[model samples]
Target: MRKSRYIAKEVLSLFAILVIAPCFAAAQGSEQSDKEVKQMIQTQFERMYEKGIQNLSDRIVLTGGVKPFAVVSDTGDNVKAIRIRQAEEMPPEIALEVLRRSLIALVKKGKIGATAIFYTADNPNKKSNADKVLVVEMEHIFGPTLAQLVPFTIKNGKASYGEQVVVDMEKQIFNIKVDEESAE
Candidate 1:
């Protein structure tokens, strides 16, 4: 009876090593792959964020106020511009809302790596650093959503921009969703 019990214990140990081990290893591998994907998306978000800021700055320098617009990067890293047209009767806030909706729609239907939306506004708080700020909202489909308030001044069609202040934003683009099934 003691020998039979010992054999049973050996079988259970073998079961754990051959079956449970791979399951645990695969879960670990899935987690690692998720991290890698998030990191790659983060890089794309950063690149597109910078591009959005530059585009806004250039427009402000030339036009004093900016038309809200978007920039998107695809999975292949191809970048493109999307201009949001505002109605003559529309306020800046209304224009911004229109742009936001357009950006969200694009993210949902496109094979997007990252996307950013840009608009200019008077700094909401007087205690804040600058009187004027360009609002840049950015997102990565599998990563994070961020809002950057970029301080800047324009003179002689030249722009001088300060370091941007970043804040965590609610995801409206792709809901920052990644397919866990695929990860598994």
Candidate 2:
């Protein structure tokens, strides 16, 4: 009877360990995944900011006032995208210029192979919901080339595309259409 009790206790201990091991491993796995995701997001944001500032320091400086920027990140099972949006109100032109410079800097650094930038220019009037959004798609050939452009007009929070603007950035010359896209 003593021998049976010893065997039964050993079996219960083994069973408890077997059941808890998986739970402990799963908890560790979750922590590791969280750390990896956070690192990836931080790395991406740092790359964008460092490359942008390094290449376009003169163009990206905030001169008029302090414009706060918010780093927005989205991650899912299949897709992830990060956006640096203006948190505080600023001139739409400045915001667009900053975004354009950052895009160019990223392209020059060979950071983006093929990417699309969807940017919004908020209305300064603050009277109506008439923000402008511009989509610039780029492709990597020998370098980043402006593959496509989709200009949109937002009225009452509705977006309507006007025309498709296409330009080859490799040519090193293109007319900036900020006025055409800004919320005027």
Candidate 3:
């Protein structure tokens, strides 16, 4: 009887370890995955910002398609008759960078003001593709403006947070809408 009880105890200990070990490993893996995704997003944002600041022509090309509410140049503000020619070809990544810079510029110039925004991952909508795209919805500090920046979904591993924006991988576009409510 004593021998049987000892054997049963050993078996139960082994079973518990087998069951708990996988859960522990999975938790560690989940944490690591989150870290990697965050790192990728930060790197991509930094790279895009750097590239945009380096070349103004890139910005022009990117925002050329969108309607500009306010224009700021080295010479002066509100340069009338500014036209952006559509290039024969534009890479998706370059377009995305340009759009981002133009919006930042507008914000800096006080053309658009927002307190907070909501952002979500639109494309892939799966755990695997969670890191693929981020949709940002901007909440205006005041009323919305007529100036609509081109809705761009970030591909090539870019992340963003805002409101009412759909990041569609299949379409390769970020669909954005403005909300008056602050989503801080």
TM-scores, in order shown? 0.68, 0.31, 0.23
- Candidate 3 lDDT, tens digit per residue, 31-64? 7644543443333232322222233223333543
1-184: candidate 2 lDDT, tens digit per residue: 1111222111112233335545754877767644543444333333333332233223222231123221211221111233346623546557645655654454444333223333333333344333432333332222333533343453444344445556665422122232233231
Instruction: Write one digit per residue (lDDT tens) for candidate 1, span 1-184.
Output: 1111222111122223334445765777867655545555565655566566556555687777686777888655766767755532478788777766666655555556577877788877677656678887887655578888877667667766667689998876666334322221
List candidate 3 stretches off by more than 4 Å: 1-27, 57-84, 87-172, 175-184
Give per-residue lDDT, candidate 1, residue 144: 74
Model 2: colliding residue pairs: none
State how far residue 118 of model 2 sits from its true place (Å): 2.6
Clashes of each: 0, 0, 9
Cα-based RMSD of the predictions, in order? 16.8, 21.0, 23.9
C-alpha lDDT of all candidate models, in order: 0.63, 0.36, 0.30
